[model samples]
Each structure stands twice: as C-alpha cells, then as structure tokens.
Target: MCRIAGIFDPVAENLQQRIEGMRDAMHRGGPDSAGVFVHPQLPLALGHRRLSLIDLSEAGHQPMIDAELTIIFNGEIYNYLELRSTLKHYGHEFRTESDTEVILKAYRQWGVDAFEYFNGMFALALWDERNQQLILARDHAGIKPLYYSTDGKRLYFASEIRAFAHAGKVFEENSKWRSAFLTFGHLPEPITTLKDVVPLQKGTALIIDLPSLHIKEHRFFEWTFNGKLKQEDEAIALMRETLEQAVERHLVSDAPIGLFLSGGIDSSLLTLIASHTRKDNLHTLSIVFTEEAFSEEKYQKLIIEKTGAKHQSFLVTKAIFNQQLDDAMQAMDQPTLDGINTYFISMYAKAYGLKAVLSGLGADELFGGYPSFQQQKKMKLVEKMPESLLRGLQRMPDHRLRKLSYVGLQNSAAEYLSYRGIFTPVSVAALLETTEKEVEDDLQELSAYYPVQGLKNGNRISWLETNFYMQNQLLKDSDFMSMWHGLEIRVPFLDKEVMLMAAAMDPAIKFKKVPPKYPLVKAFENELPEAIWKRKKQGFTFPFEGWLKENEYIRPSNNAEQKLYQQFQQKKLSWGRYWCALLMNRFTPLP
Candidate 1:
C-alpha cells in the first residue's frame, strides 16, 4: 500500500512543483521511497510514495512505465503471481517482480475488463501515452481511496484528500456536506469535505480523454446478496474454504507482516487460520484497557494461546491516550470520529516493526455479525405498518424511533439510516443550522451504493452495513489511520472471493438468532476456542465513554450543546452522539 497523486492540467506552468507538494503532503503513507513521472510534452504529472510491501527491490517502485503506459498505484494485488502466469500465456513479458507491472500488462491484455481478475485492494491511475487517456480505478470493495476534483479544466487526484489541500491551497470547503455529516456522522461515498472533490467509486473506473478532458465511468463489479448457495452445508463449506484462502493470500508480503487481533470472533478465527498457514510465527497486536469493561484482553489471550501467536498487547490509559491523541488525529486525512481506536492500534503496529497487518473488518458486514442484523426482522414489521403510524412514531422520545420518520422503504439506504443513523433529519437540521429537506436530498444520493432489490431481514441489513457503514466509516477510517504510521492494513474478510462467497450464503444459517456470525463460528468450530464463540458479542472499541469524559478536548465549546454532554455522562445518551458532537465542533466551520 502507498500514496498516489497527480494533476492533469494541460495549461499548468509548474506541474512538478504542484505534484511534489501533494506527494509531500502524503509522505507518511510511504516513507521508504518516492517517485514522480511528468510527461515531457503535456503538462501532466504523476507522483507516488512507495511503502515496499510485495517486492522489496527498487524494481517495485511505482510511477512504473512500460511501453507508453505509465502507472501510479496504491494497494497490493494479492493474486498478481497467478495473473502474471496467465498474462504470460497471452505472450506478455515482465521486467520486474511487481504487481504494478502485472497491472500494466493486464490492462494491455484485457483493458478495463482486467479489473475483474484482480483479487486485492487497489486505487490506481494509469496513463496510456499511446491512447492519450488517463484511467483511474479502485478495488471492488473500495478498501483503498481515490479522491479527485475538477475545476472544469484541470483534474487533480490522490490517495488522500489532504494531498489536494496542501498542493498550493487547492482545497475549498464543501459546506453542502455538513447536513449529511450531521445526519450520518460520516460523508457518504463520492462526497468529501472539500468542494468539487469526490471519491471514485469502487468496482468502477473513470477514463479521462487527454485531449477533450472528457471523463467516462465504467463499472466492472457491483455487490449483491442473492444467496444462491441455499444449502446450509454448501454455504458453510464455501465460507470455510474461501476464508482460509483469503487469509493465506493476505499473508503475501515481503516485509514483516502481522495482524490486529481484536479478540473478537473475526480476528480470533483469522489468527487461528494464519498461525497454521503462515510459514513464520504469526504476529499480532492488541489494545488493552485498564477499564475492565472496555478491554478485550481476556478474549485476545484466548486467541493467542490457541494460535501460539507472538502477541503484543498495549494498555491505552487515558494519560497515554491524551499524549498520543493529537498526532493520531492529525494523521486523519479526513475528519471522522470512527478511526481513533484504529489510529492507536496502527501506531502500535508500526512500533512493533511491521509493515503490513491483517484485519477482520468486513466479517460483521458480510456475515450478519452486528446488532442491526438481528434487529432487521423488527424493522421489516415496522416497514409494513401504516404510513400514518410510522409518521407518528417519529414523535417518540426514543432515538431510533425518531429516525423512523425517514422510513419510506422505497429506499433501503433511507430505511437503514432509521436503524443506524446518528441524528434524525430534524435533529440534524437543528444541529447544523440547515433545512431538513437539504439533509434528505444529500442522503438520497447514497442510492448509488444501495441494494438493487427490496431485500428482507439479514440480507437487507448486511447490504446497508457493507455499503453505508463499512464503506464510509469503517473502511475509510482504516485506510487513513493505519497508513498514518506507514502501516498497510489488509482486510481478509473483504477479499473479492471471500465477499462473493459470503454474500451467496444462506441467511438462515449465516444470521442465526441465537449467536451472531453463526456461519463463521460453525465453519471453524473445531479450530476456535469455545470461550471465544460462546462469549457475548462485544465490538472492538476504545473506552470512549469513560475516556471521553476524562478528555479536556471533549468539553462543550458552548452552552448550546452542553445538555448533550450532560446526557452523555448521565448514561441517557450514547457515546456516539456525544462523540459526534465533539467531532463536529472540532472539524466544522471549515474554511
């Protein structure tokens, strides 16, 4: 994994300086090496910061060029060896042992369709000097980020939005997203905090014609949960086999690799699998707490014992949290409250002398491993209730009930927000000083990532969890926070094959009411500790409820929002609500 940036300004006089500025802004993502490629004639420049994960030699350095095709890429292609073998059958020659080279050859062989064959996370920009067009593509799951902005003539793109901001002050605040941010606690896909800066959607590519500066989008993949594997046994087998394969593939790193062992169902299973599969001793890092209620040390210990893992656990006291908090938050490429836990753990990983680490991020989204999945049945019942009754439900004092005001069921995203939303539209408008209609309109744009059909129960909730919550908050947080320490965080659960296999599993087996992640637990029951699966499901989270209270930076800036903080401390409100307010107060009023 690395950082990439470029400017496609046909009229720019100082392309090198602009590209280098963006590259320097993202230097933390790739501290080992850096490279720049500027067209001799045209005023276009491509910049890269290399982390040196797969191929350690200078040959793997990016802004790679081969036969008029120039490329700058971030994220690893885990299956590059297999794809390279196949490409060689098509009579392609390789000069280096690098996935970036494989990508250049694959594009020549299959064009845009080549994306289908890649099984890893990536966000890349390819300049085909022959065709005089620039192509941009992200991975199938959007695990990697690619942000771009246009001023009607120039196109600027990067792996992080901050790269654009520092490139001679190219940043302009997009105040329109404040409504969405207040409602969702995060910006939805294709919307960034900067004006005209948007993320390139995953499973899609944009081809920019160098001459006309025209851009066209091509979607190569779209996620859907059709549940074609109806038989429980078949679904179980596929989940087991695919997960094992994903764990194996994610271990393909030239540098010292490890995993973030949360001691949750997903991470425990991955540790067990990797311990047995990896040639070297499995390394793991975990965050412990002095607060017993918040720490997962007990569960993490269970996994380490079972796997015989080389474990490193750090205790995150409020003192340490406060001391490290500034640098961690500064590492945020975009402002969001979700990544603080990740920020600390990634710092831990870097100090452990590891370059890449595995995470179990997508398992909950894929296998119905969240409370929202179990709550879907009640939501379905509510969706069938009278529209008048549903409208009245909004007046109730309960937070989730108040969100029901948006439940038309015509939009899955709208309905999902009713369960998972941070603030009700009315509440958001009052908080952000904007109209409710404006908030709703901004939220409506999320339909691009919505489920294709009217899904029921677990399937509906999973789609929303994956596309909305996972993509926007969890995955985005993982990208910037982990990369802050120059550590590449790879999620095996979000692997292309693993996602497809999990999406096709029978929901009845996958989303068993008795236990969350039933399929995942059952598939490897023999391999996992009984204590790990039988334990009540607790998410891997920092002690924010307790720690936020200890934080001086978390205080209310004004009395207008003081009641919210009081409610939070009194345990009448969720820490998320209070934390969202803190984040909003700190990051908003953007310039």
Candidate 2:
C-alpha cells in the first residue's frame, strides 16, 4: 500500500535528483511519509513513499536495512509475523514490527529464495551492499505492479509508469501497444504502452549485478491445474479452507476496512468471513443501478440480512456515468474496458471514510468463473475439422456465428484475442483510417507473444484469462480506480496460497457443470441464502444500454446508430456492444 522508486547506475553524477522526481510523481500513492537513501558513491538511490498501514511509526520507515542489505518495498507481506519467527532463529534483530524490516532480514538470511517464504502481494527492490547486486521481485500472482526501464548505464524502477516518465526519459507512446489496446481493450502484460518500459511478469524475479550490469530473470512460481484428487467434496472443502485463511490474512490492517459486496458469491463469501472476524457489525458497501435488469440490490439486501452486517448502497445514474467516463479513462496508466465500476465503488468507499476494502477479483479466474471456460469445451470439436475447411469457413459473410466459428478455428491465444475483443479485426480495420490487413498483421505479431504452449484447451483459456485478461484488464483497472480515490483494495482470492490451491484442483470441480464460479458457490452454499446462490451471474453489468440511449454526449452516425439500434431492438447484440459503440462515440469529436 505504498509507492517505491529507485535508480541504479554504476557511474552517475547526480542520482538523488532523479530519485526525487520519481518519488514526487508517485506522491498520490503514499502521502504519509517520504524518504530517500543514497549510496556512498551516489551510484544507487532508493526512494520510498510510505502509507503507514502496519506499524504507523517512524521506526517502520524504509529503505529499511540491515548490516547486509537495504530494501525499498511496495505492498503487504501478510505472513511477516510468521517470517519474523523463522528469522529470529538466525538471530536477526528487528528494530520495528514492520513487514519492510522482515523482508530485508529474510532476504539477508535466505537470499533470493526468501520470495518462496513470503505469502503476500509485493514488489520489492533489495540492494545487497555485501553482494554489490540489486534484486527485484514481484509477488507470486502480481497483485501489485512494478515497472522498470534501463539505459544500460542506469536502471530506473517505479510502482507506476508515470513515475518513470519523471526520471528524464522521453515519454514516447508505443503504437503497437495502442494497436493491441484497440483489440484487447488493454495492453497485455510483459508489455506496457511505453516502448522502453516493461512490467515485471508475475511470479518472476530479476537480479542485477552492479559491476557487469548483467541482468538475470527467473520464474519463481507457476500455477498448475492438473491434480490427482478426484473427489468433488474434497476439492470444495480444501478450497473453502484455503480461501478462508487467505481472507483472514488479508484482514491484517490497522485501518478501518470494508468489503465491496456485489451480492455475487465471491464477494458474499468475503463479507461473511469479514463479518465473522469483526466484533461489531461489518460494514458492507454495494452499488445499485437504476435499471432493474442490471441491479443486484435485492441480492445484496439478502446477504446483509443474512449476515446482519451494516450496509450502504449507492445509486449510479446516467449523469454520474457520463461525468466519470473521461476521468476514468485519464486515470488509466494502461487502457482497459473495465474499471468504471471499480472507480465508482472506490470513490464511494473513500467518501464513507473507509481506507481499505477487500475485493473478490481473482475468484473468477482461479475457479473457472467465465463463460469462455465452458465455451472452450464446446469449441474443442472444431480441432477435428480439416485445416482447409476451417480456412474456407473464415471467408463466410460477417455474421455473429461465423465470427465465433472463425475464433474456434484459431489457436488458444488467437481465440482469446477474439473472445474478449470488442472490435473484431474486420470491424476495427473498417472503422479506423488504416487498412484491415495492417491491423490483422499487428494482431498476429502481438498474438505470437501469448504464452499459448503453457495453456492448453480449456486450461489454456483459463490461464490466458487469468494471466492476461484478469491481470492486464481487471487487475490493472481495479488498481488505478481504487488508488485514484486513495483507497487500498486487497483481493483475498488472489492470494498466492489460495490461488495455488485452486489451481491444483481439477477443472471439472473448479468449473462445475452448473455454471461459472460453481465451486465457490458450492463451498459457501450453506452460508449464503438460496436466493443469492441461485441468481444468474450478471458479471458486473452497468446500465450501459440505458445510459447510452439517455446521454446526449454519445451521438453515433445516423447509419451506424440505425444499424446498431436495429440490432439492439432484435437483441442480436448484447447491451455490451451498444455500450462500447457509445463509449467510442462519446470520446470521438464531431467532424
């Protein structure tokens, strides 16, 4: 819940100024305190902006160091208490009860292997004075973000891309990333919208040697779904245990916390657990839509009654939606189709005096809670068709079924590109001033980078959804939206231990025959009211269709609107498409 930045140069004249600029840009992330540590030779400088969630004392101040190492860390180590006990065996004296100190001590005792002992979200930079090497690592699931850029002579890193822009690097927009953005709704991970900057991939670590300037990246963790256990009951029980522990650990915060109760199974379960831990009634917040079809107020009301938690709800209207759309887009460090809801929710939480809120973000990805998972199973029949026939099918007219069929013929990565994509290759090309062939070529190039081999069939779709769709789209969106209101969001379901346990369960149990997030629904069956469990997963629907039709800001071309309106009238396209078109129109200036 803090911002960290640093610079590493074997030969640099003034490193302090650069570190100061980076820290200044990240002031919004941490306003409680700020500190800088410059090495004796000025070759390395570490900057930190503290949020003071844990110790709330000057003793928790970081660039925290021991005799061997100095560390600039961002994020929470939920298992710091556990690690502190283990480090005591090695006679490491702690000056404060801070996770930052625990991390420095653990790294000193166990080296890079300390990442394995951590059970929380983090991105840390440890300057090993003894080894004369700098080690950078992200949490197992990438719940927090770390971005870095190197010019061979100097390496600069920060919690946000904006911070890096202040380090005297020209802000050149990356066109290829923009192209990917148009297709995927967000720039996929390992690649940012900036050419020179890159995000450290999830479950990976980097070690940089000071003298040689050589950098080594290692994959410290990987999630696997293949498990030998076959019993559904056993899987449910194990998932319940892991998830409860994850939620309990995430609740370790000094500030007043709440849950973003969506009335969905994931959030419902979180609210229940948080309520159990609180002596007083738990505070639960939810968004209510004016449009009944998109409202979950009834379900949320049911959960509040069942749990006996204090509840607050906000009514979102078209006016609020229109006003916030522009600010939401500008707040994005990377482009994403989601986050509008997250932004509004976080804003509400902040206004209500809540500093932190637990979210149920990763439950969908970890427990097979997307339609794409079940759809991929049905799509498996396409592999049996001849390559020639599949190629011929792509030549068919522009129809929804044909579009879906073409996606089925593609590889897992390409299929994923099509599934979540708003504007298809044909559509984007036709709409843009550029040629369709160019867009297709660009998509192919980007698709090549997708980790297709690691993902196979439904599992492939699941991984792509988790690592790419959820990471780049949902998680990125949530981070900016929540942070914009200065509210820290903790996703308990995304905890490494919980995710690993879920990943190890059989896919059949993870995605039951009933529907998406079936396992989660089944695990908390008794705790949740029957009405809440039986409700269809609406998937965070905003009243986009109603909003678009009401807002005058969105004025589509007569021809386009007529066709789009006709489709809407016939229910050919879900309300989502009209909403996308409306968003594009709202952003587009009149000729």
Candidate 1 lDDT, 1-591, residue by residue in tens: 899998978777778988998898899999989999998988789999989898789998878989899999999999999999999999999989999999999999998899989999999999998899999999999999999887768888999888886555446688766666667888877678888888998999999988678889999998877778888888888889999999999999889999999888998888988988863678999999988988888889888877778999988898898899888778777667689889999999999999999999999888888888767667777778788887676556777678777775355477668777878777777777777677677776667656447677788788888888999999999999988899999999999999898778777777887556888888998888888888888887777766657778878878747878887777767788777877777773322
Name the weakest run of 10 consecutive residues (lDDT summed) in model 1. 582-591
Error of 2 at 312 (Å): 1.6
Error of 2 at 272 (Å): 1.4
Candidate 2 TM-score to native = 0.90
Clashing pairs in 2: none
TM-score per prediction, in order, is: 0.96, 0.90
RMSD after CA superposition, every candidate: 1.9, 3.7
Off by over 4 Å in 1: 384-389, 392-395, 408-410, 448-452, 569-572, 588-591
Q: Tell me how far candidate 1 lies from the true structure as C-alpha RMSD in angstroms.
A: 1.9
CA deviation > 4 Å runs, candidate 2:
9-14, 279-281, 381-412, 431-438, 446-449, 454-457, 548-591
